[model samples]
Target: MFRTIFNTVVIAACFFILTALHAEAAGFKDVPKEHFAYDAVLWAQKYEIINGYSDGTFKPNEMITEQQFAKLLANYFELEIVEDELKKQTTTEIWSDEFYNSLASYGVPLNGYLHNSIRSQPVKRGVVAQAIAHLADAQQNLNSSIEFLLEHSISTGQNPKYENRDLQKFFGSTNNMTRAQVVTLLYRMDSMDFYYISDDAEAIHKNEDNNSLNERAIEAKKQLDASLQQNPSSSNLWNGNYRYVYQWGKGQYERNARYVTISSANSKDFYVRLSAYDGKYEGTTEGYAVITSAKKAIMQESIKGNRCIIEFEHLNNAIKVTEIDCSAERKNGTNFSGTLRKQ
Candidate 1:
């Protein structure tokens, strides 16, 4: 009798162990065990954060819509979608009204969401970065959110204008993000512990909340300050990544984003690539600027025989853009003139 009971117990234990080991294999026709997002898919499944389709297939490659993403985030975070947290604005999605309201109430950066046809549009990766950064305790702005993701091991995005790649990776990508990519991001975030800049440039984590103050932005500021001290007024020092976000309402405002890249610098001037992007809208022009002053450089282009001038001004930790009749190049109500902060 004793031997029979012992054998039964051992069998049960073996079954339990096998079940536990197979948990990571998330049962989906499309997701194989060797898939890069397998672990994330497993985690998302465990938490019911994102689920597969009814046909027993996870369409991991499907493009996620903006409203759908917003709702997914709200549910994943278990945020209270209060009705009173309403945002008085245009570009509202009549469907999934709660999700849109929650996004506004939560103060998540409204990057491409504010663009027209909010319901049918796909959310940009920048929007994803901003929302995730907010949850990770970063400031509620595009630049800060982007810096947070980079500082944290969440993403690696290099502007395509500089890189040879066709599509921008990470937060800079204007392309629509896939469902699997987002799931992988969430999985990394949930398992991430700390944010530390290592000498080897590898991902490191320590604290759970990551409340430790971000030192990268601090270090960058210090470096710029030191450079300024060395040369009080130098346009050559202005070669760095800078971006800005602007918003306007009710047919009377400007809602857009601008990014400028300056590189390959000499003492006199440097190469500049000015790009404007907001989901479906984009305009780009690159040219060499000969520095005529310590804080300003101007580029001239003729649009339809009308001379258009673009000015770049170097300020302390910021770059100011001023355009004279560059409207022909602007799209989706984007104005390239604004105060952009260093990333």
Candidate 2:
């Protein structure tokens, strides 16, 4: 009888251990082991980057707020908060108004989420993308953040320009982010090099004589430059209003165009258009090119049936173009020359 009782207890103990191990692999109730975001979600949970509800459901479909995500990043990067709190508040108190204030002190914008009033609103995709970019040491401006997203492959395809207030037109910018989406982005961002500073901005930055702080800034710049080279600037890096002169030959008059608009969505592709012109060319000439490298681009343009192959070389902030067809007035491959200066 004693032997049988001991045998029963041992079998139960073995069963319990096996079941416990299986649960770890199974993950949260809503997120099954086979879910596509299972791995990322599991990673976040394991590292205490995110949490499930009291009901034991991960609620992967629920929308996430900007403040909520801010806390997650703050905790993930171990950003030293300047606030002190020991209150026994309900729910997520760390993601409160004080938390955002603390983050802003560290140059971390809440990304339009602001304080406790609008803090409950769901964070838009654009906001999350921008915040993640800032965490990676990208510039705080919207353009740089968008470019950072393009470089990191977070936002695929062309990085088109969009007004900050006009978020609806921007692709993937206006959508309300789901919990799974937030976690997945965090997972991707975590894989990159991240840097942060304490919320006490006055101590480190204001004290210019601090050698250690200056060294850190130098190191940070080096790392940022390395990251920039990895993606390379977008072809649109040079896009903007320009003042250009088109000459038939050396010092010969062709036309002078003011406010020429140059636009390139991706680093490898580009477009140039004359907004308003005052010159001999009655019609218009539109040129497009494919950037071959950091310093060279292959351009093609046809001006009134004149086909020319133009090569572009990066000269400081401006681009110098040399045309192959030297003879003027009519040839299939007539060359010309021009200079474009950013306005």
Candidate 3:
């Protein structure tokens, strides 16, 4: 009886060990892996487009820096860098390192707005869209639908907001993506197709007038030109007229300001002033203002210069403005002020 019991116990131990090993082997089976990104990473890694961490884990969560990403693109696309040419064009520091300089020379817009901060931020989906679109445009391999989407995406600033359901709808219910979709959207902005449909059939029919990719490109260019006219200066003084007061506080007041007349003929120069007032203790107003743009409006207050600087761009078919800095000086207790007009 004792021998039989011992033999049974040994068998049970073997069974438990085997089960544990099996479970361990299958542990990651249910984990949704980014196979497409993984494949890209592998290619990137092999080509030194990316590298793993010191701990040997590739923390994809880490923001991809603009500089690093530019280099990656340059390497993949074999872009050339012209150091002397870039230096002559802009005072901005071109990533002149042998690898990064190539990207700069490839007309990548590494100057002014396309600065280096892109590297430190986790590579956003929208950025991925832009990059991919750029690549497709360069290669002339972009499909008409993809081209339309890319142009619209950049002009309107639309980026992928990956909802699993949305992904499934676009990529199919398999929840798996082909290398084509992954690479195109990941590297080329011209990979996805997008359309704007209003709640009414009339709007849809009207949009049909500009349905083709070429038409869309023309429209986008026109819009960009209009935008440039509106905001001629990379940094400019935005003016408006006071319309109605919205809110007020002890040292501050908010009002809707109208445009009296703008010095610049650009419509972007004209805005409905949502102004805030701070008492005469400081030369500047303690409140903020909102200026609407083709994509979105902005709310900002003065920090250091004569005015506050608000940064904006199109993303995901909308305008997003970020408050960059504020400039207000305290003078002998008088606020620097302006007005708005109706017509």
Candidate 4:
């Protein structure tokens, strides 16, 4: 009798543990035990991809806004948020600017959906499908994002009536994705771990040979070095495109950038093109710079009767521009004196 009781108690304990695991999201009072999204919500909560309200309610049926979905994807992908103090107090910078810009850097098109005006509005399902297609690396030969989702068994559209079973689904692309549906979509995608976006921003992706991101970068660098060697007659390394993304105190976000392009002009001189545009103002000038030292050059240009002389100090894959009386080349708060990285 003692052995029998012990075996029964052990089985009962196992059953209890399984039950607890099954209802891992029971902490959310609004999520019923029979809810379809219980498992997905639990998974999302576990991974910190989604959170509940202050009242401890999951509200799984609530519609996710544009910013909310951006935050969700950021949490899932561990994307770094880049904030500019210059953009903080501007009239054009919205709360979701960093999140959207970060996602855009990863090649997600804005498509007029992530703008500040509609940031609080419900994000449509079409945008979600596009994100999934890009995230899963299913972007090849894709007629449409919806078709791609169906082909990959990632989705079967929002809902459907009785029809030909194979060709029977219509994903209301404009419909707002519910919280439960968003989590469920993420949970259903089984191909999230194949392609990894490396921390190196310039790493090339999408290779038929399956070369890793860093390996591709190595190959690309080798090719670029060869090209630069051919561009310059000698070992001069200043023949490439260099740019620095800058954010002005004004409302300009992406247009605020300084660019420098150097090309071999002759045996002793290099053609340099410099431009700085910050939406509110624009300045551009191109001239020839003669080699001064092993890693330095001087360029002179007269713009609107103002003699402009600038010195270029070349570094490893960068150039520092020092302006000397280049006031005519710069106008209305436009200045192109900064260090730029090789592109």
For candidate 3, report its TM-score.
0.31
Candidates sorted by TM-score, descending order?
A: 1, 2, 4, 3
Measured by lDDT, the strongest candidate is: 4
Per residue, candidate 2 scores C-alpha lDDT tens digits across 153-226 of 65542224654543334545554566787787667766764434333333433435543422433333233222
lDDT of 1 by residue, 1-343 (tens): 9999999999999999898878645567667788888778777788877767554556565456556677667666655554442332344446566665554444444432333233334456766776666555644455666677767777767564644443224346454566788878777776675222222111112223332222321222232211111111233366555667555533212346666666434567666556665544666656666667878877665323434467888898788987655565454433446788864
Q: What lDDT tens digits, residue by residue, belong to model 4 across residues 195-261?
A: 3444333222223455443343233223211212121134335665666666545343334666666
Better of 1 and 4 by lDDT: 4
RMSD of every prediction? 17.2, 21.6, 18.9, 20.1
Compute each candidate's TM-score over C-alphas: 0.46, 0.46, 0.31, 0.45
Model 2, position 174: C-alpha lDDT score: 51
Predict model 4's lDDT versus the native.
0.59
Clash count list over all predictions? 2, 3, 45, 0
- Residue-by-residue lDDT tens digits, candidate 3, 166-256: 4312322212122223333333332232221113322322345545322332322232211121222422233211221223443222222
* Ten contiguous residues minimizing lDDT sum, candidate 1: 223-232
Query: What residue runs in model 2 are displaced by over 4 Å at the alpha carbon?
Result: 1-26, 84-95, 111-114, 155-170, 195-343
Q: Model 2 Cα displacement at 221 (Å)?
A: 24
